[model samples]
Target chain A: MNASITPITMPKFGLAMTEGKLAGWMVRPGATVRAGDDLADIETSKITNAYESPAAGVLRRQVAQEGEMLAVGALIGVLADADTSDADIDAFIAQFNAEFSAGAAEEADDTPPEPSVMDVKGRSLRVLDIGHGEGDPIVLIHGFGGDIGNWLFNHAALATGRRVIAFDLPGHGGSTKDVGPGSLEFFSSVVVDLLDTLGIDRAHLVAHSLGGAVALTTVKNAPSRVTSLALVAPAGLGPDINMEFIDGFITADRQKTLIPVLSYLVHDKGLIGRKMADDVLRYKRLDGAVDALRQVAAANFTDGRQTDNLRPVLETAPPTLIIWGKDDEILPSSHAANLPDAITVEILPDTGHMPQMERSEEVNTKIRAFLAH
Target chain B: MSKKSYRQAINEALRLEMRRDPRVIIMGEDVAGGQGGTSGVVDAWGGVLGVTKGLYTEFGPERVLDTPITEASYIGAAAGAAATGLRPVAELMFVDFVGCCLDQIMNQAAKFRYMFGGKARTPLVIRAMFGAGFNAAAQHSQALYPLFTHIPGLKVVIPSSPYEAKGLLIEAIRDDDPVIFLEHKVMYDDEEDVPDESYTIPFGEANLTREGDDVTIVAFGRMVKLANEAADKLERQGISCTVIDPRTTSPLDRDTILDCVADTGRLVIVDESSPRCNMAADVSALVAEEAFDALKAPIRRVIPPHTPVPFASVLEALYLPDAAKIEAAVKAVMNHKVTEAA
Candidate 1:
């Protein structure tokens, strides 16, 4: 009943996750933690992601033990002032459990939003469209061989106060596997069409890697409809790329072979697990996926050099915000150098090609402040 | 992805492959069902257990042929068709019936490419139900994967779950070599989340179901699930284990097995087949020969005794290796110690 106490529950990463295990607590009961700090390691079948603290306070109690599995939204710990009485904390936990078990979770509408197949320009693209607002809606575009799930960490956090759309490109995820032409120009048209199909006129384009090239080409082709561009570890600004990743992503189908290839995407190779390779392999085995990937690779990175230079588009670009991981191996973060004076480029250390995921809270905060102005 | 039973998963794999490729066909005894039955044939039954329930209606009799009850003739015909530019998925009804068609599979189909100087390709899949459970006595129940595994040219697959069933079946249908796809009869109703898209789990790779530090538990087919359960139960008592499911028997994941043994220094193998030359003995020999120096304890096997599958429900339960039996085997291995450190 005390307004000062904030219960730390399990975090749901994706749509499919229902329960997670408290792999271990990163902080003890008496440790003071800030919001967005690592509180514990919560693991699902697919991944073991850090559970961030929701409030800045001392950890008063740990309700769930290490390795204990609990459903999403189940209380795992408590954050409150150091002087909060132990008896008061016990009463609070009792009341919380009673309310949670007596239909509060059912009535709270805590279920994560699900992605659905939407017909865009004669192709079926799986889209997860959530949040709602009047400000320019945000759209996320993942890189090569990526789906809407690539935005797993940032999508929901950034969706606050504005409608955000993350969708699978053609030949990726649950989308139609035919990627027409597989060129940045062709993909740019699809992105523009997707925006039109969603009735999103003048929206923020938050694109990554190959999707960054698409965003640039979209601005070059149709400039009036774009409000701003947030490119993360983007392409089209450089002449160099890690061809090993592109080549391996197409050829390596086995988990043992693919794990090392996926390690190139992250700074911490420990995060690269079998489930990630399995998921990619599952998508690759679908009918036209490999062919589409090959075509995109050929068009985008021919002989390891960037094919289309959309850097010139920046001279007349919209409000641009470029975020790159300093440890990015796929696309060198050095490409963010010598940008236009008006552009805001942020380089995050200790992250890789996927800074949106590896440093989601920081990226979300930057985008929030960037848009607030 | 959604929860699909083993029966549904197999049917979907067959359906997807047939839709993708025109050369694929299905032939077996009662595969189309209702052939020469009390009522007129209308593709009513899918198979003996209805695993192929709806393919007959979708593809029609031209592709879904209900062959004469003779396993020898139909299996031979399937092999011949496969080599002559058709991908035929033939059902053997029960693995015990393989005795009737062993020559066709062992000699003709498996050796087609090699026998003909790498000229002939037999994309043949022979699906059969195996394992002893639900009172399917000796005549109908047998885990005959080792027989197929013995043949060099044949690829033997034993899927553990619905997800594995769908992906492996699709791979089997597409593979150029002769594939013996064994489905445990009791698993048809077992359910798990299987993807809707067509996918393939490559051969010769082991899936580690549980990873731990104390012992390595290698199991086959249904035993993989049991090993996982045992590992979970053992974890509470501080005996951690790493459970491995090799998925395929013929082109076994030897490296994964050897690596696990080298790490844990203890091994427990669970196989539901008759004990003589089953996977347990085969893998036990593998670890003993290659990674002998890494052993801290002797390897343990939780397999059925060398006897025919029993007829009574009570006897059959005793004949099969359960999770409790696997747990006991693991505990024994964890406790075994060698004073010499050899």
Candidate 2:
């Protein structure tokens, strides 16, 4: 095996995923792929997602057969240079299997780190804080009706060099459902309280959809505390909004109806799986969850129009990057238009409101590059 | 989401629903001991297995009523309370013991809405421990969900995992009609990632735990886990299996079953109930009737033999339908080749 040999392993979709099934391989043994090419469709407990290649290389060997169930980090395939000998590839796989089996005992007991509940201002917030590098940390704010798990594809990718903190706002996920007044300022103040509670002096804010408006409000309320801003299909820049999605999200309780409601978030309707709809239904079933969502909708997007127009906050805002899916249904992509030339904007085609999830690679790359400055 | 045992999930569902609705109450033997016994009422054995342990303390004795050992009396009282106003959740302890109270459940609770011209609503839930794994003897250990599922106007729930238990139990409690929620006795200690807040899984939706191309394995309750194990082992041998857990039996998701059979062309039903008159027979019949053109091979059913459950650990284990048995049954159907007309 040459030093260029890169083994393709099972990818964990979320914090709770322990193992996944290789539903099928998208490429043949000798096919070459780019770094982010879809290699296989991995079926987890929650969804069936395309597993992307980690590095650019020629596919040397398909170590794991299609339909095989493997734990996270189990070798599924091998990628190497075209010139590498087949003998060397076989030897490399033998060594990899030897080592994987030896470590299997310790790995059996390896539990995925879970999101913990944090007490902020007498209310509990569910927080998933990852990365430990010494730099200004990044805080992720999900849009209305989303939780920390929505950042499954971006959290670890963006956390390579600095810290990334993803949290469930009040009335979402495992967080306390007492979203006081459900005002943008109330949500923004909770962000301030969270910063104080975590004892961070400065941090980057990356938000999507309604969360973008909240992040902008936080920047306006406490300017010094924020270092940068990255918004995706954000609200608060325009008065136009999709009330159908907002009302449907609060009302659709069954899987049949909820999938259609969630389909508004992405361009690929296939991305809306049964498990995804089930998870939303599960969250909605929690006590006070629907009421909290209703309150937020009534306060922010009152009468089918956005209540706040925080575009003026960009004048003095720190380095900002805005990425909007051109096909966004919840909030019009046109909101990203007419922004100050000083702020950067990237419009992604064939995507929807949740560019962070639908096109995580491009969104993460832009956010990481924007925050590097 | 946090890791919660099947016991904790059920407990949380009951507590949350009771808190949310003042009309919801719980009654069962030893559900709240210490009424005349030694252990504190709040801390006594919640149900026979400590499933509702903390409810007595929080809701006090009034809501968490500890009833006498008479299954007929308490179960009848629960049905009556539900018809009047209160949403009552009564524990039947062991499902086998339901034989003594069949009149209350069958003739009374299950018939209220239909017999009363759809005017009276009976919001009653009967929770019971079922399925055979431990050496709890014949009377204590039996998979008796099929019995209640046969009755009319009854929604029967057999939750497969901790997450399913919580959501399905809450849905049962809130339902306007009568529901029989069966929990596997051996799975109380089984843990899974369950959300803290209350959620309800609709009664009729079939949850496909695994999807594949070769075969569709329909399982219920404890057998769902075994079918999953068998499916994983079969996947390694290149026989991919799609495992479906029909969360409710009374309102069985027949569309999903027929649809999956149409796709896979092979059906394997794993039911823990007795070989005769079991869900396996029912599903096999449905596929034979509606999906006959889709069938590439004869249907296969994996079930326990028609005999009483034994107390001996080894015999009981043999009496149960396990992963090995299910795997064998699946492979047998896979091997069976349909002869075509020449």
Candidate 3:
């Protein structure tokens, strides 16, 4: 096989997908494509997601036809040099399929790491500990009603050579649903307890949305325990927030009602797919899930506004960097404004509140650079 | 995002709900062991198989209550507590013990809302371990879901995997009506990637584990896994099958089952319970009555004999509807030649 020939296979969207249908191909068989190009629409039980091209090449034989259901990692199309012969492509396809099945057999025998539940101050917390290195450990904190899965795209990217841990706060994910007070102090304390449980004295904090407030409070209480802060579209910097999104997120139980509500969190409304809404609804249906979310909303987002203000923390906070989506609808990008002149703020355009998810590649690059320094 | 055993998944659901709502409480015999012991150590055992382990430690004694072996009194108290505002999750250690508390569940809790003309709500969940495999023998290992399915105003849930267990258990707790959540004792150690977040799989929706064109295999709970295994093995020999897991029995997903049968024109049911008047029989009747025209072959039911679940491992293996039996049933239905009625 030539080094230039690349096999474009089915991509796994979320943790739950086992197989998906090749809904359609974006480019024709002979069309030239580049890396990161939208190659095809892969439809799974959860959502219809666009499969991106992995490499730049002339689209060769479409091994798997459109509308065909294929398992994860199954070859859907082949990308090869225009000069490659038709006979060679056929031989390569056979060899690749054989090797792919062999690899799958080995994977079936391997045991992958799973997320674990941790007992922190009596609350059952879900933690995802990934990577290992000599640098100060990094902790990823999700926003309100968000779990460590929110960092799905960026977790492994930033954990290249350092230990990175992400956890779901109380009332979120597999954590205990009780959100006592749901205040910045309560959340910050939980973060501190988790860090202490992990035996980390000081670490870089990468927090998003409501987690931004918790990070601010943690630095205010025990500034020594934090090495640095990377806040992404974080709360606590301003008072104005999209209450519509908050209330809609709390009340929207079905997919139809939720898609519009979640649209406020992204620049592209199309990103609010059925699967995303279904996932959120499923969480809300859990016993006491809605009530706990109500407490958090009332405590933090009272009177149609953010309840906490940690602008002062920005003055004395350890080397902090702020990344905000220029089109953030949940928290205004203006919060990124009026910040200390020394703090480096990157307001990404054509993105929304969930820049970490919408433009994960760019967001991860900024975060990795911030952490390295 | 991680692998969690069926035991851990259920424990997480109970703990999350208990913490989220002060009204949610857990009661069962030795759910929290070490009650009134000479050592004075609290939370001695968390269920007979430790499925509820660590819950008592987190929720403490007030929320995680331990009851005596008397099933009637505790189960009645749970029903009462649920009616009076508390969302109680009472454990009936083994499903066989339901005979001791059937009145509280069937006649009282299940009928409260309807009897009161929709004024009353009983957000109660009775979780019990069912199915045979463990040496627990005949009395302790009964797949008694059909008994509860016979009752009205009651939701019957039979979770197929760790993911289903967590989601469906949470849904049962949040539901306003009485829910009978049955767990397979043999599946406690079965692990799968369950989301750390609390999620609920809606009731009455059947999950198609595998979609095929040749035959349709409808099964419930542990049998769903077996059907999937059979389908995989059959696919290798050019015979394909679709496996369905009707997550809830009462709000049974008739549409999914009928649609699959209609598509394939062949049906095979694998039920773990006794042969007489079982889920397999019920489903077979449903298809015979409703989708008869769509059928190209007679429906085949792979079930154990009406005899009690045997004690010996060999007998138990023979008595259960396994992958091999399901495969044979599918082949039989596939090979069946339809004859005109004489």
Candidate 4:
């Protein structure tokens, strides 16, 4: 309760990240830290990211050790003003641990996140709706071979202002593997229908890769329904694509083979962690995912090249911001060059195809800025 | 509807299950191949032996899963999904590939129901090609039903022929418990009258392939075919034999074994797997323990030597417990020294 005393607790990177490994402390004990300062490096199952300080204070106690894993909201370290005594911080830490443990137990006893499946037309779609607020809301459509978790890093970040919705594209995640026609139009209609099912008149469309293409198609078809567009390394704008990556991703069944193929997605190949690859493989193992992926790939990428050209659509309507990774081997960054002056394209260097995952902070900032405008 | 191979029957069983139940799913590497190929042709290789052929086309992608060769994740996912809601049928491609995903099948799926205090029902089925005659050598050609039968909560089924294949497979798919349905790779082409409509052959029921009086011949999977052959030969020699195919090993028909032993008074069990702790030894032990008084002679077991399945034709033939060896075992059991009215 003290004004100067600040609690440095565990941070949740993504919605699914309930716990994380305290890899190591960046700032040692007694170090003076300001808000947004790198306090520690936390490793989640998906990726490792630096834990930023929430308040300006002197680091009094490094309670969590390196390699120690703790649930989100569990105190790892304590921060207080330089004038605060050691006894006060110790007492605070003890109280915090007790309360955190009690809270975790209460949460455990509480009902878990209810994942509901809805029948959209004939196909079954799995959807997770979180957060609630006024305003048009935000619909998160993940890219090719992505699910709701693809927006794990960005969804909550955007949810602070409005209701955030994320779902697995057909044949991608928990959603139906029946990608009817597996085309941009097919997916865009599903997204549109999902919005209708959720009773939302209009929403900010945030999408990645193929989802971006879908978002563009949605806005093109019904521009009045989409308020804003956040396209992350979108597909339809590009001619050159890494067919090998797409092919390897769909074909590689074994862990030994898949690990290498997944590595192509990120510049820091390490980001394509074992669990992520395993998750994709698990989705691929689902009844219809392979066939759906194939149909989708064929419909979208004919001869290893994207079939849909949405540059014209993007140029027509809806505030569109194109964010691409300069080193995006999947869909080369050069595609972002000749985009119409109406569309804003930001190509970040030293990043791969998955800018949302690799450069989450930068991508989040851009999205936040675009939404704000 | 037309004349279908045993392979096609199994495929139809899967296709029918997928259609009947929305929860039922099929997954395996190359089960529906050509995912993102240059030719844009998907579902090219329905399966390694084309057992799952045209399934992807019929059911589309959602129900017929083509997994990446990552057996652990997919198989484990199948177990996890089955535990959750879906009834997943995972193909290990060949029974030999069980080496990779055995942990998922044995530790996870098999134990989920018992370990979870009967609250969990892992209605999962792992279909794998087993048995010899494919010249697939040591790795691929293994009659490993014994390994699966040893595990509790795991209902192991090795369909002897196409008739057994379709019914048993349907039963395995619909079963509440996890089942390891082993199909004889050699018998995929072997035709037998199979009903088109969905039907389940209950476990623990022994199919009397051949009935006679001189000796009781117990066999399983492909060895059932061998035992039938041996029975025919023994009959021609005036030494009649009853060949009993205990359809499932886990829910083994102990009553049938005891009843058969009581009738024949002489038992000869044939198992293609190695001699050490094989099904032959298991049935022999059962007859020795339960039907000891009914026995007129010693129980003889015809099984392969305790060694890896050989590659060479001669060595492989010797390693496998064939009809000739089974016939020899039947004769040996029939000629065993009869003790004075024990």
Candidate 5:
């Protein structure tokens, strides 16, 4: 392996991506590239995302041509120091290609972990359990109308040395669409049932948006079962929520309309790409999906005010860390204030309601550190 | 998401919907079989080919009801149930058996809303297995989607793959109007990556399985698979082709079909049904009427002859339009040219 030569491979933008097309190259051959700089435009089934350079070097060769589709981890380009000879660079490219082809073949044979449907008190729940280690485990609960896929960026990162489980709530994801009353209490009970089904006694509950409210209710209801709480712009923390986002999300059917609504979830509106909005629309179009979403909104956000006030959970709850995005239009970051001084709170700047996604690195680091303690 | 066979996909759709709403029920012959049997066992045969297997154990008998070998009474009963309250998914066993229950489907379920001046809604889905390949003979194999397509108030769906089956079946169950969901019996074992989540692909929307420039191939049900294979084979010969699966034949995606034909300047329709008055003829008439000026070559349809589906393996193989037939059809249309009036 050459230390100076760096391989810029096809990046996997999301969990579902198996292959991507090199739509175009942002940095041409002989161009100086730095880490985090856009190297190429890789298009996946869901969206076209800019492939960032993972190393700083001079772009020696664009091994994969524009518009050529390649499997994830396939060598798309090569980077090396400017002084590197052509023979050395050629050798590096050849070696990388040989290994990449073999790796691609093995990957083709290795299936990704599939989400399973469990009978949680007779309500079908879809859960993805990944990674394994010693610990109480990390239970991820997604927000309103969101599925386990919402944690696509953070779940693997946080599961380094612990069992991390992410599940679709009753009415979301692959779970049953029948949302009984769609209240926080109802959802919390389902979560409890899931934990019971998994035979997990105690686990750190990492929740996002409405899931935060559900986690709070769960702690208040059954404190012993939860090890810790990591709230991300939770519902019960405030009474005010952006009703427009909820309504738009539930009603918007087409890509053009849904894309703008998804923009509210992140500070960088560009993150609300075609594939992200398409995924939401596909979920919404499912039979009983919109109705379940409506029920959840009516029960949780009645008349633009959150019905649940779980602030008391924070006062006497387990070691809790509250994370909120300052640019969150759905739930104001100010709610992070006026909480018990005993509870540690971090308000992320330049991030919206979904800090776990926008600032996934920071959010994952914070969560791992909190869980460690 | 994971790879699921067409059988598993349909089963999941029915299971998910039944769990979601108590009003959604399954009724069909041997759907949850072994009722009143010597063995005293339940769920013996989950439908003839086990497409509805494991659902009975999950949902139980009340929702996953098994009916007698009576299509008329049971299909009629399904229509009545849908009108009253429950959204019933009645399995017709074989699409050829629709002849036994056409009055209930075409007259009762299909005409209820219009005849009653829009006061009634029949949220009924009649799933029937269609197409030939298993040597199931004439009665057991017949792509009769055109019958439902001709009806005024019916929505006909013929899913091409496992993924499409799940979504379209879910959509059919949730739809207010009567829907005829035809499953190709031979395709039950075909597998694809299907999301476990409940999703719906809207009716009348065509799925472009492959995009190309030289020709456009419109196919339905089992024919879509053959068309794709033919397109791939043709691509190697330097002649590219677009393969379109008009998922729902009745609410056919005419615009997509027409647009693709215009782009490619040639058309080849691959239909598994009999030649006369089939989807191929319907689509041909549509293109000729809407896109005559765009056509640079004559339209061609690759379909089974007017004779009944044969019983023997060799004859049956010839009876069904395979990839060779589709490729030849595409090549014929591609080679076609406008002649000067000599």
Candidate 6:
């Protein structure tokens, strides 16, 4: 019941995460803290990441031990003004625990978000639209072998102020696997049609890897629809690509084989965790995913090289920002060097092909700043 | 494009196929585990052996479906889905689990095209972990491809290594006919250089792993591994033997088998399945009928006795045919002299 006291809870890494283990605590009790500072290390099924302090205060108490597991949003530690009493902190902890447990129970009754499949132009596509209020919406298009959940870390973060939309491209996720010709144009048309179905006039398009090509194609085909473009380590602008990575990704079937292939996506091989690899394998197990990927692979990267070049289209488009991983192994970082000076380019160091995943915080910051302009 | 385990190869094939076709879906118990649990975790277990890991996250639940333990409904749904608009790769989990959903696979998926007067393409792939090893006991292990090979409408694929696994699986995914893709549990970790591109190995072409003029040895699935082992041991003893991997059982490369039989004038078939009505019996029948005049010795079959796979390691080892049994069979075939010194 202390007004100055606040609780530091176990943070949710992504939408799918419900619980996280306290891998380690970064700050000790009584230490001064600031919002956004690394407070603790939380390990989720997908990856281990540092939990940031939500508010600035003094670290009053460590309620959860380093090794204990807590539900997402459950109290892991306590923070308060230096003047707050120990008794008040204890009472606050007890009250917070009770409230947290009650809230979790209430949430247990709430239904999980159900992804809807829409018949967009005769092809089935899976879409997840989160958040509702005004402003032009932001649409997320994932790269090759990626689905809507690839934005699990970014979607909700960006949705706080406006509606954010993410969908599985045809042949990638829950979308109709039959991608006609499996070309960027085919995917770009689907994105525009999806916007039409949702009644959106103009929106900011954020795309990664192959999705980057789709977004660029969308801008070229229907310039009025795309308000802004955020391309991350995109494909169409590049000439050189690691066809070995693409081919390995499409062909690998088992864990021993896939683990090494997936390791190429991130600078930290550890980021290519068991769950991430398993997720890809599960997608590949789907009946039509293999054939769809093959068509896409052939259309996009024929004979181990990129087939499309959209630098000219992108050079003339509305405000654009190109983000590349300095250590991107899948698509070489050199591709980002050839961009027009008008196109703002940010090459993140110590990152890999999946800078959006490996260095999400920095990437998010760049994206936010670009969109603000 | 380097050495990969048999497990890695199969996983690669599934990964590639799923990436290629959006209509292609994967369904099985725990294939993408943690469905409807209190933890709110999805994709908990990729597969019993971790084969389906990483897919649920990449493709999401709708495409990489994690079905309930009830095999009949899902397997039948797979068949239904395939016939309608999807290419469903339903994992039966294990070959032994086939008992729970054989009707869907055999009666529905295997019969649709023919019953429909050749107007359908049931591009359904039923992937099941097969063979015995790891002391998994009776319920978890069984090499049941023989049951599928007997059916007329089904195409049976049994890949020997990682390279074969990727190519054959891609082929199965692309084929219009219903295919039963069997992965030997024991061979999953066995590595070989597998290509990264989407390429397929044509069915019915027997891969001659080793060639020799002394005797011809044909094997299936795990037996092929044993045959290679036996061939290697025999080579040291000055008795070289040819080892052939008949990758597909239904389209049993009878021509290849007969040609080898005629050239060597002696035959030995190593089949892990129980003796009666198996690939061994099938090959033996082909040689007996077609190459009756060229036979210099009676055909020898190294197979497990007609009994349930035992649980104990010692008993299981005895129950399963090994390189020793294969070597003995080859020697027996080679030792025969047509006229006893004529």
**For each candidate, how many residue pairs have backbone atoms clashing (under 3 Å)?**
0, 1, 5, 9, 0, 50
True contacts kept of each: 0.43, 0.71, 0.36, 0.00, 0.64, 0.00
lDDT of 4 by residue, B131-178 (tens): 777788889888888899999989999888876787788888888889
Ranking under DockQ, best-scoring first?
Answer: 2, 1, 5, 3, 6, 4
lDDT of 6 by residue, A1-373 (tens): 7768878888776777888878789999899999989898787877767778889999989998876767888999999999988888888998999998889988885543556777876877888888887778999999999998788778777777788899999887777778889999988999999999899999999999999999999999999999999988998887788887888999987555788998888886766655667567656766568899999989998877899999899668999988888989888878887677788888888888887777677777788888777
TM-score of chain A of each: 0.93, 0.92, 0.90, 0.90, 0.89, 0.90
Backbone-clash count (model 2)? 1
Using TM-score as the measure, name the better of candidate 1 and candidate 4. 1
Best by TM-score: 1
Please give the TM-score that candidate 5 achieves against the real structure: 0.75
lDDT of 2 by residue, A1-373 (tens): 3579998988877667788888789999999999999998887766567788999999989988877888888899999999999989999999998888788777787776678898998989999998889789999999899998888878988888788999999988889989889989999999999999999999999998889999999999999999999988888899999999999999997776788998888887777877788788879888789999999999998889999999999999999999999998889888888889899989999988888777777788888888777
- In model 1, the Cα lDDT at residue B295 comes to 89
lDDT (Cα atoms) of all candidates against the true structure: 0.89, 0.90, 0.87, 0.83, 0.88, 0.84
**Inter-residue clash pairs, candidate 5:** none
List the candidate 2 regions with Cα displacement exceeding 4 Å: A9-27, A31-57, A103-110, A239-244, A267-270, A302-305, B34-44
**Candidate rank order under lDDT:** 2, 1, 5, 3, 6, 4
- Residue-level lDDT of model 1, residues A222-250, one tens digit each, is 99888999999999998999999999999
What CA RMSD would candidate 1 show?
2.7
**Which window of ten consecutive residues has the lowest lDDT sum in model 1 chain B?**
B33-42
Span of 10 residues, lowest total lDDT, candidate 3 chain A: A106-115
Judging by lDDT, tell me the better candidate of 2 and 4: 2
Deviation (Å) of B275 in candidate 6? 25
The residue-by-residue lDDT of candidate 6 on B214-235, one tens digit each, is 8999999888888999998897
All candidates: TM-score? 0.93, 0.91, 0.67, 0.56, 0.75, 0.55
Tens digits of lDDT, candidate 4, A69-156: 7888899999998899888888898888899898898887543244467787776777778888778889988887888878778877
Which has the greatest DockQ? 2
Range of the 10 consecutive residues with the lowest summed lDDT in candidate 4 chain A: A109-118
